[model samples]
Target: MPTKGMSPVSFSPSRASPSPSPSPSHHSPSSSPPTPRKTLSSSMIAENVDTAESIIRKWSVEDGSSSYCRLDSVFANDRTEAKDFLRSVKNIQSAMQFFVSEGTSSSSEQLVRAQKLMQMAMKRLQKEFHRILSSNRNNLDPESVSSRSSVSMSDFEDYEVASEEDDIQVTGNSVHEIVAGDSVSDLAMADLKAIADSMISSGYSKECMKIYKLVRKSILDENLYYLGVEKLSLSQIQKLDWDMVEGKIKSWLNAVKTAVKTLFLGERILCDVVFSTSPKISESCFAEIARDNAVTLFSFPEHVAKYKKLSPEKMFRLLDIYDSITDLWTEIESIFSFDSTSAVRSQAVNSLTKLGESVRAMLLDFETAIQKEGSKAPIQGGGVHPLTRYVMNYVGFLSDYSGTLSDILSDSPQNTRSPLPESYFSSPTCDDGSTSALSVRLAWLILVVLCKLDAKAEQYKDVALSYLFLANNLNYAVSKVRKSNLKLLLGEEWIENHEATLKQYTANYERMGWSKVLTSLPEENPTAEISPLEAREFFRRFNSGFEEAYKKQMSWVVPDARLRDEIKVSLAMKLVPAYTSFYNKYRGFFGREVGVVEPVVRYAPDDLGNYLSDLFYGTGAGSGSVSSSVSSSGRKVR
Candidate 1:
């Protein structure tokens, strides 16, 4: 069955179907007709068109609208029909574009109609192009399969249906590109210089300084060369313009210098707004702002030192400035006893504590520097320099603040049952004998003062104990000096007076019927013995007769009556028994004669016997003469 010159082709289920076998009747006249290659001719195209038409007809019937109406109209051959056909094509093209762009592709009918509409629009465009050409132009053939395969179907679909307005470039393409060897450091420095210039022109020297800081951070030492050139270039260009950033910085420095001078002179009005307005606001707000500004000033010690080099007088002036501000704080503290609100009180306390800390730090620095300098020289008598004197004054102001803060805390309700906070108690002290660096010590002293004023015996005791401990543990170098000074300042009378005061208070408390002292007594004290019978008798008598007498007396003492009959009767009844008991006990103890008593015989003189009998057992009214004789005899016996 194989023909000559025909190569056999094998069939496999997985492989694409081999081209349809050529017909045997069309054999070549040579040894064997060359095997005819299988091709899809126009007849196959016609068959596909028929199938597609059939599918469109079924879809129209099922979908209730003919999606192929435009195709049908285009093939129709009348002028009126052709006009309608073109219009239909335009409508179909518009609808298909909308469906492709906005509608989902899950529906088979929508996808088919969209594809068909696109294909028809392309053919119309080709035909229009052909019509525009002259007759001498070569006929343009339909796209070949190879050429068509080169163009992606999805790309063609998008081009035909996508709206031009929706074509937006992605960020990847729109971003500014940085070329090779372009230094970001140089660019950033230039930007900063420009910002600094603008700020200067706008009268914002402080802001310009901030911009310079940012620029410094952006450029490292390794990239300084590049940034320096950029900065020089910018500076040159700005010089011809209105840029005065450098001038403004110098002006700022001058202003700072003036402020330092003013502060040194004790002029508070020239201080920063935060410092000047602090006393007028709530304690907390004042404290927070003051602390923040103080930190800003003291954060850079080296910078401050460099600034001081502008003038030796400026260095001394800086010390005066701190002293003046601290003095202001002292005055403010003196005006307010204690802030009523807790938050405000806390702020006030914290502010005072921070102020003390700052003063201490500054004093320590000055003291260290002075000591170092003094050690190298032949400074006699350990005399303080002018700077040291200013530091000491500043320290005194700190002590005053500390005292005020302690007073405030002592008056606070939260601190009622607790010891003073360590911040209040543990402030640093100067070893100098004077009260120069005595803020912490003076705070304790103030506590003692308050205790003395209020007569708080227990608090005084605690304070004395704490002070004694502190004095004893002081550094050996200053212990003797400080202790002597402390004794002198406190006086010998203080110790004796406090002891006497404590005793008086204790005695008063005891006399006021306070029984807590009985329990508080040392266990070594002897306990008194009491019989149960006696105790019961005493309590029973007290509960009965004592209560009745008290009520009767209390009731009988009425207005306008000197004495009431009932009261007199109650008083007699109550006193008679006590008097009788006292007489009986006294007589029993001392009435018996110590010497030997002679026995009285019945034979004794009748008068003496009668007299004795009357004295011993005289219930009846004794004759006045007999009673007088008996009294005379008793006196003779004594």
Candidate 2:
């Protein structure tokens, strides 16, 4: 049962309990006047008013003024005093309603006095409410508030269970354990709720809501500013340099995670708990406090996407922002679930859409960059072309973001004309039987680079060097794909196919580069009967042809050490044994019978092997200096 002279709607701040609904009999103004009775306790009502007046006056700001002494601070020191204060205010209101309902003309003066006391009590509560909010700014910070678990309402009656122990537990340990536990924050929330419940129930919701929105909105805006979220227009973002834009984007990425996960989420929880009795006010307060900042936070990405300078280099940062939002989509939906905050949700989604569109544009722009590469000069030594390095490196990095790109590219339209043959995609490159748009898109970019490489190779005038250029560049592409996530995306079969193409290029280079040297050796068996003249002629031709081929190819470069070693070993296999057999058979015979001015055999078989080892070093040094590499057969080429 409620206290005799108090309204029945009391709640204990320490206990977690729902607001009690007032009984109509307890609070409603009687429609019919009560019958007059001789036993009516007029003195008893007077005594209740006198008791409430003393307590109300004890905490009044002045003798009679708008401001009132803060009550929660007093409550913090002595909780019983707080309970007496709330009960006293309720008693004053109860006494006022009693005289009005009984229609007692003689008690009008006592009723008026009760109303004045009640007004004074409410003013004290309003000041106390605002004071607690302002003083506990750090204690009620969003991160700490958001980390609290939901309060479980006790089964017992809240008013009956109000205890000093509960108050001590709530206020004494709240600051130290605000994040680790919920006592301090709960105490603060319960206090705010108690004041809001009283104020709203007494028809002062406008003032309560006004103070709440003003303080909380300021806190939210300050937190957002510290988080580095800015509201720059598209033109402003466009005018910023790339480094500045990137810095802002990185800051946003960091800020958004905390904002969505803690700040806005905490505010929502705080509002709902504080204004539990008035849900419309809670929702309105939350929307007013959080929606604009959230929209500002999300709208930044859209502004960045609207940046006029779209380049392939900027794609990763855009994707980073896209990935950040994509990661928090479910949380964003839940945090801003209220219909009032739908614009915040819409802005997040709009930013994602714009970022996706920008990434797609960058992909097309990158392809255009490949096609329009106008550098006509051939790369020295037919090494890897700059276009090949740039494209492969770009594609290699793209593979790291395959999962994000899959979502972004899922709805993108397919290219009508690909640089590669239709058969390339149909091959095992799309080994999963389903080709994702990202896989196809990345594969298309790579093929554009390959086609561009084909054009770059033609810039080389030497046929053999052109083949070497293709071999070197294609080897680089295959190596890049093999080492990165591109292998999973483009599959083993694609690597194998490209490796096979690389081998064919290597073969074409070998066949073209060595034609003169190989053809210089006659097909006749060296043991067959041959005159000294024929023998001399063979050695002379072989020396001249070998020298010319070695000089031409020694300056050529094969940058990949494994590929370089493989080519050298392969050439030694083909060239070494044949020359060794011919030189062994002819050297002694030419020296004995021909009496040539110089030795008829200008090179030992080992000398030829030594020179072949020096090919592809890009040194172009003569056979005077041979590398320490041995022949293919494990013999030192001395």
Candidate 3:
């Protein structure tokens, strides 16, 4: 029971929704510089009008469609103007049908005034057409005119255009001419066809709106001409036609493509259509159309291959698209079928649940897409890629819609959450403070990503490079997790675990690189071999080993300045004391050969201490400043 006694969801029997009237599309003004203008000529105007008429005539099935005459011709060579001219022609005919039936049309002041105005405007244009045709009027006799219906000025007084019609005729000729004489039903049907064509052409921008208006205007005119029913039944009057249905589908497809491809505008249009007030159209009809559209938008991409092909911008790039679709779709129920008393949001809940499933499907496909690429060219052993950042960012947004993901996992038999430590998610560093399933799930995803990154690090062949790669990636993940709301779910335990992992990587690096050199020093036994040559040889190996290690290792990267400093100190603690003591004991034993008084040691023990402290300090790694750093390390080593 539609509250407004509007017609039953009316549609044309033979054609799609009313043929779209030629009309300008709704357009936002361009910010770019103005396009160059082109001049309009009579010939261009005539050609365009001919083209426009052919399009309408081919589509409009009304009995006297061609007789519904004279759309204002577009003369300007300007493209926009040409289009407007074509639309104007359709609009003029729409007005013409209503104008003819005005004497018997509805009593609504607004509708009546609008029809009267169009009639008057046409009269003015007709006067102009006459001015142009005046020189040629001498060639035609009163009865010779075949295309127009002739009436005397007195006989045509009912339309209030007798004076205007008189101007188009020969001087004192009795005939006042009108171009058409279509019945209300025929005119209404014709207008419907044209309106549908227009909508298909540019209707979705505001279809529920423009179509309703055209229908209302025609109804007012139709009522004046013949007995019209208050309750309009689409099926009652004519079989609901396939052409109308196809037109609607075409418009929907176009809208879906627009929304799917964009950053935002298509979503806005969809939202507006979903919520527009159409008192004349049946709610059930609108709902069915909307549902159909939703199906087209979210369906079709069933598996990995299809989803991948539909959306090539995977990982983070799809977030904006995901957001617009999910958010707008979720709100449909609230807008369309909201129930105040029930706890359930009648249609929206189910709609959203389905929407959630659709999104989850697409996301699963995204994993397939990324993994496919990963198989071909494995993730590099470095910090997170920009694509990864975008994926994480989108997940952060998806946190708001976590229920959708939660629903997907509901069927799992195993307890999804890990047995938590008492301090899990409790610490400031890790806890997002949310205890919901979505929070836990998001936290789980974060851990999974970290594990994947760790595996990527293992790809590097160099043990030292592997450690550096791990350090860089782990550091980035830590920073992002800390900054994101994912922190709330990540909990203190996850943080503690990752932090411990970082320390282990650091320790591995220190042991492999710095510890080997520290262990190579000679024992400090007093009874052991003490020859100057033995001491010299030990110094020689130490010099060669330490210098090579220092030079080779210094340039190796450590990206985080704080972490780099910490590593330098930890290695220095192990190396500085041993080197210094060995130097002290050996310096007295190794005397200069012959008169060459050059120092036997290239660097004093103090230099060793300073050099250890400066290791892994910058992006370029000490920048040939090993000697300078030794001076700055705990012991002065000039």
Which candidate has the top score in lDDT?
2
Question: What are the candidates' C-alpha RMSDs?
Answer: 34.4, 8.2, 21.0
Residue 597 deviation, candidate 3, in Å?
11
Regions more than 4 Å wrong, model 2: 1-50, 62-72, 90-114, 149-183, 415-433, 522-532, 592-597, 622-638
Candidate 3 C-alpha lDDT tens digits along 1-638? 21222333332232222322333333457645323331233234334434544544432323255453343332212223323333544453444344333322221232343333333333222222222222222222111221112222232222121221133322111111222334322222222232233333332324334334333333222322222112223242134344443343344334433332321222222222223333223333333333433332343211111222234233222233334445565344333442221222332234344444555555555555444435224334333444456556666666544444555445433224554433556533214343445555456555555556566666766676667667766766666666766566565567677889889988887766655476567755523557878777767767667776777665566556666666766666666666777777777675545565544576765566556654554333343333223454243222
lDDT of 1 by residue, 143-196 (tens): 111122233323211112112223433211101111211233212222222222
Give the higher-lDDT candidate: 2 or 3: 2
What are the per-residue Cα lDDT tens digits for candidate 2 across 1-638?
11122122221122122322333343357465544552365666677788878878888754554244433354466665666777676666667667676554455656666666766677677777777677777878899777753443321113131322245333332211233234566667766777777677666677788778877888888888888888888889989998999999999989999999889988988887788777799999999999988998999999999888768999999989998998999989988999999999999999989998999889988999999999988998999998899899999999999888988887677543344454454333334455556767888888888888898888888888999999999999999998998887777777888889999999988889887777666675655667767777888887777778777887898888888878877776677677777777767775554555555666766666567766776885523223334433333211
Model 3 ranges off by over 4 Å: 1-331, 338-355, 362-465, 522-538, 584-599, 605-638
- The TM-scores of all predictions, comma-separated, are 0.16, 0.83, 0.44
Candidate 2, residue 2: Cα displacement in angstroms equals 46
Model 3: lDDT of residue 336: 41
Assess each prediction's global lDDT (C-alpha) against the native: 0.29, 0.74, 0.43
TM-score of 1: 0.16
Give the candidate order by descending lDDT.
2, 3, 1
